[model samples]
Target: MDATESTPILLREDLPGGIARLTLNAPGSLNALSDAMLAALAAEFGRLAGAPETRVVILRGAGRAFCAGHDLREMQAARAAPDGGRAAFADLFARCAAVMQAIPALPQPVIAEVHGIATAAGCQLVASCDMALAAGDARFGVNGVNIGLFCSTPMVALTRVVPRKAAFEMLTTGSFIDADRAAGLGLINRAVAPGRLEAETLALARQVADKLSGAVRIGKRLFYDQAQMGLAAAYDHAGAAMVENMLWRDTDEGICAFLEKRAPDWPR
Candidate 1:
């Protein structure tokens, strides 16, 4: 269904070659991550975890921008409660963190199709993805410091993806980085002309979808698992993963096909 129809806050569209596109549709608030939007994303990612047919997922925002950040109005309204929104704020950030962590946890690779802007928690969302492609005019920042609040939550993912110095500069200065700058910072894979963003993103997604799904899934998991370990332990973990992957019939077929110069007839 289209964004205007079912689930206006979030829309899911499936395409050929197992690519699923999720659009954040709340353009009026610049696609802010409202409570409902976060819930929608969590539930959708839950479904995707069990959906083996979906090889890749593309997340984008509709209308003017990718996402501005949290819904400040919603957050402010919570302050009317007796506790001054402390409990509400805590829950909101916890939920947002869960949604961010779910991206790398999903079996399918996620590509952020960013345009216009991705700031604060929005920038964190891009960092959480396996990869990202932004429009040349797209912008990124963790500018919560500009309003007296530090972007501590977004900093978690930001620091992991970009260098510590670069992340610190953006976090402290509350400045925006252009798409090309973001690419250099390693927050995104690359930037393309605004008109070509979608095409280029889909091309990358399709290229990934063409790989052996089982191997890619293993590699994705291995990539993340090894990152948090000591060097020796990381190699041990990756070696075990390699052992499991090498036993897959498709992996054998891929190797044999390469030697024989024939297309692999991988089992479905």
Candidate 2:
């Protein structure tokens, strides 16, 4: 099989400065996370995880909405299966969770550029990223409760980024919140005008990409590793990373450059 077969459900674009943009391409379905799309995402993210040149990743959806969540039509079709879709649903959620976990596990940082509406699993995608930038008018919610499905999967990522009360309200009430409110709740990093969304997102990605790739990678790894540890353990883990980083040749050059009032000659 050709390892690089192109899929219509997803698009990958390489930009300068080691920045990559992954676009969800099924706008007609509101960029829903169908099985095929999830597979495509997993494939691309897997490829990127080992790409030493990629320093940052920006995720966005084509057309109006960022994503409307899972493809209900696809799920409904699986109801005729031997087990009444139980097996299918289980596999779907498992694959989706793997893709979500892959974001933070990647050596590079991932940023979500969102607009229109990001609901249910879609909102979970935003929360899974290292950071998110959304259009001022974009709406977000984990509204599976309205359809009796209950967004239990989405709650995993949502509760991690936002406060418990805020996450519970959105999950239970199936209510949508504006981008500004999402930002204030810590679900998104910032909210900009619709016309400026792409530009602002690229600008942020470029800023991150401009940093020393080695330092950034180490920092990203340490950030997530320490986040789940107790205070003492976290400090111990972070201290080791700091000591290792300080001994790197690039770090020495950076410090010398700073004292000499000149730019560090970092590798591209």
Candidate 3:
């Protein structure tokens, strides 16, 4: 086993079939993001991003809740620190969002394997992922509004995942959306039975992994790049990307295989 398998932090990992399974390990804290947890998570993700053995990443939490968002105690403590000079709270939240964004920006596909409750920033993490899968019984939402705190940070990612009105409904109501409803809203990609969460999530991740790694990476990169462009420019951007994709060795092999009526052998 790798050393991470024995660590107690916000995330742990197991390398299997080129898939990096990152577990949100702080069950007692509901996988809350403490300074340590955040640092550990960033470090682990960084490692996986550069690791040749990593082709895909699966994110899930231990126990019930995926993540309870930030550890309030740590938040309060940071506010009390000497560096708490000004906007310390804001600064911390900014850092958190930055790290969260990095996960999806990585070349490999990221799948959020969610179960139980995912609330506040925890729900934000789910929305930020490339794809999300939740157990049919899973519940998700940004509940910060319930405590008089706006889920402003989460809104950045959540807005992109669901309709404006739908996102705002959860924000205003601080109510949970069921997994199936989440999928309908585009917040989750799939919803399986609670008992089948793990197997189902892994199955999806493997489906992605089984495809051409290079192609998936290029597609993922172009997806984010194209998403930010204006509609008219997006088509142009896609065309340019398509040209680049066609120039790749795998693309040529893929087309050749199709024409020849045989399965294509992909390169690593």
Candidate 4:
């Protein structure tokens, strides 16, 4: 249902051990990236960026589908604006891109809990996350081309995660891939049974949250930063990161604990 003043566009739940769950709440629209939804996401992501206590984030949608992409009605309505909605369209896309970029920029690793369908920009959302776990029955696609609105923005994230040829085929054909196929394409970590999707995602979130938060934060930043560099540069950047990481007191304690055959007594 469309979100009324009494309903939230997005919902956040903080679990024990610093795991934060953000649910896209516009199920009536399949969590479409409407202007209000985009604004809510940006605001929540901004808040999370400063929340050092949040070690991991899991983004999911309420209702049957994860997301159905942009709201067609909202986009069509923008055409009523002066300038033929060109400026509005541009601003909308820019804001959406910011939210997508914020995923990797976050200190906490973000995991997408996907079910049902994630298409067009929704698929981009999945690809932008650090990792994803989808239900076996879930479907993914960048199908804007079928409507004459090529998913160029979504393509940016899609191409980075999946192979070039595969991305191109999906974009051109506007075909959806099942979760197993998506996992094989490296789009998601794995596909779990529909009944187990929530439990599996929460378990993975807790597993990551259980790690040393400082190390995970540093490593997450370096991982994305080094991915864009030349091999030699990447190696140099990674080596420097390792040096910085090794100097942490927790690292020293962890190493000592391993040698002593004891559980790591890392500071919380």
True-structure RMSD, every candidate = 1.7, 2.7, 2.8, 0.8
- Please tell me which predicted candidate would have the highest TM-score against the true structure: 4
lDDT of predicted model 2: 0.94
In candidate 3, how many clashes are counted?
0
Residue 66 alpha-carbon offset, candidate 4, angstroms: 0.4
Candidates 2 and 3 compared: the better one by lDDT is 2
lDDT of 3: 0.85
The TM-score that candidate 2 achieves is 0.97
lDDT (CA) per prediction: 0.94, 0.94, 0.85, 0.95
What is the C-alpha lDDT profile of model 3 across 130-162, one tens digit per residue?
999998998998988898889999888999989
lDDT of 4 by residue, 88-143 (tens): 89999999999999999999999999999999999999999999999999999999
Model 3 CA deviation exceeding 4 Å by range: 1-6, 81-86
Model 2: residue 231 alpha-carbon error in angstroms: 0.1
Shift of residue 176 alpha carbon in model 2, Å:
0.2
TM-scores, all candidates, are: 0.97, 0.97, 0.92, 0.98
Candidate 3 C-alpha error for residue 258, in Å: 2.0
Residue 212's lDDT in candidate 3: 80
